[model samples]
Structures are given as C-alpha cells and as structure tokens.
Target: MSLLSDPTRLAGLVTREVRTGSRDGVPTRIAVARRSYQTDPADLWDALTNPERIPRWFLPISGRLEVGGRYQLEGHANGVIERCDAPKALAATWEWDGKVSWMEVGLTPVNDGTQLELTHEVPFEPEMWGRFGPGAVGVGWDLTLAGLGSYLSSGEAVDPKEGQHVHRTPEGRVFIRASVTGWGEAAIADGDEPATAQTAADAAYSFYTTEPDSRPES
Candidate 1:
C-alpha cells in the first residue's frame, strides 16, 4: 500500500529532541525522537527486532540481531547489538563511514497504542554539527519511523524506489522542511545559537530534498 496521508502531518507525528552529553569523557550530541503507533508493544517490538519484518518498513538488514551480534543494513549503517530487552528496549552501535555512534530504541505501552522512542548519540564534531545539526540524523529517522507507521497500519512493505522518489515531490519536500525545522528548534532549545542551528537546518533540508541522482558528494 502507498503512504496515504498529508506528508507534513506524518512528519509532525514525531516528537524530536536534541541534547548534549558526555561519553568516555568526550562530548556527545544526542538526537531523540518519539512517536506513538497504533499497535501493541509486543507487535512493535517484533517489527523492530525480527529480521523478516524489518525490511517491510526500514531497510534490508542481515546478520544476527541478538545481543553481542553484528547486523548490517544494506547500503547503510552496520552495528553490533549491545543490549536487548524483549518488548521494551534495544541498543546497538551504529557504524557508518568509519564513524561510530550509538542508538537505542525504547517501547512503552500507551492508552492508544505503543510509544516508540529512538535516541542516537555520537561524538560531537564541531564542523559537522555546524553544517547539519541534529537534523542530519533526525530527518532520516523521521522518514524511517513514518515508514514504520505506514507499514503497521497498512500491512505493506514500503517500496524502496517509491521512498526515494517521494522526497522529490512537493508534499515530501514539505515534510522534509518541517522535519528539519523541528530539529533546528530542538537544537536551539538545547542551548545552540538560534541562527546557527536554523542555518544548519536549512542545509539539511536542501540536502534531503535534492534528488539523489543530482546530489553532490558530502
């Protein structure tokens, strides 16, 4: 099934946050997002951890997903599972382009459904932070989470080609713009300078909205 909803509205469903922290004495930047799904915690947890169900919403994944196991997402990040608590939480190392980051997903039962919270932490890089801010990662997660919602609601796998094409559409552009703006506001609330954060958000929006075929190398 196709993603059938107002793009901006779908993007707005996520609550985004940005904060600063330290790990191993090094400063780290944290990006967090929360969204509620109209599904039970057990089902949501299965969708997240089950290899057979992951590609239906997110990317194609391979390798063991259990604790201490390494998993790779095709053409994306590869990671070692650090922790797994069934139907509650999962944590892993997110490695991409020689950079190491950490990601955790927490699931909680809610009145209407299940609430999923994702937190991504990475070593602070002044240059990269100034260029893209938290939106660099937040936007990607927003899209991924949106896909999850669509899949859970419609019981259909998201088409990879369609997912890429959507960003070039006007509605999809609106969605990316709003997601970037939200991340910018989150950074500002975390004590980042307003102007700098918004500037980085604009960069992120442009990068996301651009067609993949024409996108310049980072």
Candidate 2:
C-alpha cells in the first residue's frame, strides 16, 4: 500500500534524530528513526535477516548473511554484517563504491508488537552534506520503515514499480518534502546554520522529487 493511498497507523513512524558527532577523528552524522510493527520481535527479526522473507517487504538481499559475512541488496547497497544478535540488534557496514557508512538496528518488544530503531552513521562529506543535509538519507529510511509497516500489517509484497510511481506523485512529493524539512530541523538542532540547513532541505526535496536515481531506499 502507498503512504498516500493509505494513512494507517502513523504514530510508530518517526524521525527521532539527526545528530552530528565524530568517530575515529572523522566527522559523522547519525540519523535515528523509529517505528513499530504489530508483530513479534522474532518475526520482525526474521523479516530483516532472512533473505527469503526480506524481498517480501524490503529489497532482495543476498550474500553470506551470517555474522561477519558480506551481503548485497539487489540494485542497491552492499555491506558486511558487523554484529548480529537475534531478536535484539543487527549492525552492518554500509558501503557503496568506496565510501563506507554504518547502520545499526535494534528491536524492542512493545505492548503488542515490536519497536524498531535504526541508526545510520554517515561520514561527513562537505559536498554531500551541503547538497542534501541528512534528509538525503533520512527520508530513505522513512520510506523503508513505511514499506516495512505495510508489509508487517499485511502478508504481501509491496510492488516496487508502484512504489516508485508513488514517490513521483503529488502526495508522495509532499511526504518527501516533509521528510527533508524534518531533517533540516534536525540539522539546525545539531547546531548547523539555519539558512544552510534550509538550503540543504530544498536540494534534498528537488532530488527526491525530480532526480532519476533519488529513490535510493528501493
């Protein structure tokens, strides 16, 4: 189901933070997002880790898939599994070309489901940061969680073509715009210049709404 066509349970989905920090002397930003699923923690964990179940919601992921192993998402990013603790947490090194980022996800049992929190740590590149701010990536996770929500709520695969088309629609554009704006607010909260942050959000909005390869979360 499309976010625009369907507005079911939106409370669990949120962009928690966009924090600027340093790791190993390299400047970095961590985008934190949270969402809940009406499913068991173990079931949610399976949806994330089990390659066969992943394509039903997320992308088609394939590789060694074990802890300390390498994995690749079809037509998307590839990474090495840094850590994996069942029904609790999973961490990986997200790499594209030669650039390396990190993604860590943790699951907690909620009243009738599970809360999934994801932290994406990105190395600061002046050009990249200046161009898109954190929304360049944050919105992708928003899309990811939204897709996951649809999947967990129903037992069917979300059509990628339909999803791509939805992103180009007016409603989808507004969603992306809000996501970019949220990231800009997050950047300002992290001490960035207001003007610069707004500029970045605008750039991000344009890219997501117009750029051919902007749908990175797919």
Candidate 3:
C-alpha cells in the first residue's frame, strides 16, 4: 500500500510524545514516537540494522554498526553505537555539526506485528525550541517511519530525493501538517503554553513545506 495514498492516516499511525529530563545536571527534552509495522520484530530489526538495507528506507549508512563502534549516515549525523541488543533494543549517540544527542530504538511484539519506539534526547535550547519546537526532530522521524513502512510493504527502495522533498507534494503536505500538529500537541502536553507551542509548530510547518527556491523575502 502506498503511504501517500492516505497520507493523513499514515501520519496518524505514529504516536508522539514529549518529556523533560536532566543529563548530568543539564536540562534536556526528549521526543518519543511510536509506530507499528505489519512485519514481525525480527524483520523490522533487520530493516533497521542491516547496513545493506538501510538506504532502502533511511539514509545510506557507513561504518561499523555494533556496540562501541561509530557509524555515519550519508551527508547526515555520525555517532557511536553505545548499546545493541539484537531485534529488541539499540541505543546510539547522534552527533552532527558539533552537537551531540542521544537516540534509542526499541522493538516490541504486538499482536502479530512489531511496535517500534524511537526516542531522541537533546539538550534543551530555549532559542531553538522556541523557534522550531519538537517538530524539528519529530517530523523527520515521522518521515523516516513512513519511508520504512513504504519500503517494507513493497521491498523496494525509496527515492531519496523524492522522500526529502515529499512535503512539496499534495499528500506529502498533508502528512507533514499532521505530523507537525501532532508534535505541537505533544509539546503542549509536556507543559508548554498552547500559544507558544502553536507558534513553534507554525515555524516547523513552514520549514518543511516551503520549497527551497520559493522562500518569501524577509
């Protein structure tokens, strides 16, 4: 089934949440998203950990994938694999552009399918949060989950370019809007003022939906 066929429904498949935490006395925010796939845990784990298959859904990954090893995502983040428990849980550092964050993925069996939960923890930046909110990272993961779903359904690779600019398409726009709204609601649930969260969501929505060459003059 094409994810774009029912973009809203596809976006709704994932549940998003936000939480606050402290890392070594520094405040942080965590964004969590959960989505279920029709495939079993083993298959989903293969799709996530197999270097040969990663580019089929997510970015092209290089370097070792085992615990204590470093891996790089093509043109994106590179980090150390801190923990790895096959077909169940994985944790890693997500570092890019001189900043570091933590990420964990857990897979659980659920009614003949698998539930994948992704949690991203980053030090809270007031400016960045006020500017983009959790949608900054949440929506990207939402897209990744959707791509994984598409790939698993057909066993075909997703075109990276099309996936990157999907928000420009009608269905893609709908998907992105729904994702942004979900993140905004999650932020509110995490104690952010509704107006503030909505403002941040608006910024995130524009960031994803605007075409590179079509930016309005400031």
> RMSD per prediction, one decimal?
1.2, 3.0, 1.9
Give the C-alpha miss distance for residue 190 in model 3, angstroms: 0.8
Q: What local lDDT score does residue 32 receive in model 1, on the 0 to 100 scale?
A: 98
Query: Candidate 2 — worst ten consecutive residues by lDDT sum?
Result: 3-12
Candidate 1 lowest-lDDT run of ten:
1-10
Candidate 1 lDDT, tens digit per residue, 1-218? 55636887898899999989999999999999999999999999999988899999888899987899999999999999999989899999999999999999999999999999999999999999999999989999999998999999999899888787878777778889999999999999999999999999999998898867776666
Please give the lDDT score at residue 41 for candidate 1.
97
The deviation in Å at residue 11 for candidate 2 is 8.8
Which pairs clash (backbone N, Cα, C closer than 3 Å) in model 1? none
Return the lDDT, model 3, position 213.
78
Which regions in candidate 2 have their CA more than 4 angstroms from the true location? 6-12, 213-218
What clash pairs does model 3 have?
none
Q: Compared with the true structure, what per-residue lDDT tens digits does model 3 show for residues 1-218?
A: 45577899999999999999989999999999999999999999999999999999999999987889999999999999999999899999999889999999999999959999999999999988988899989999999999999999888899887887788789998998999999999999999999999999988889889986775432
The runs of at least 3 residues in candidate 3 whose Cα sits more than 4 Å from the true structure, single-residue gaps closed, are: 1-3, 212-218
* Per-residue C-alpha lDDT of model 2 across residues 11-60, encoded as one tens digit per residue: 22574688888899998988888878899999999998888888876789
Better of 1 and 3 by TM-score: 1
User: Which 10-residue span in candidate 3 carries the lowest summed lDDT?
Assistant: 209-218
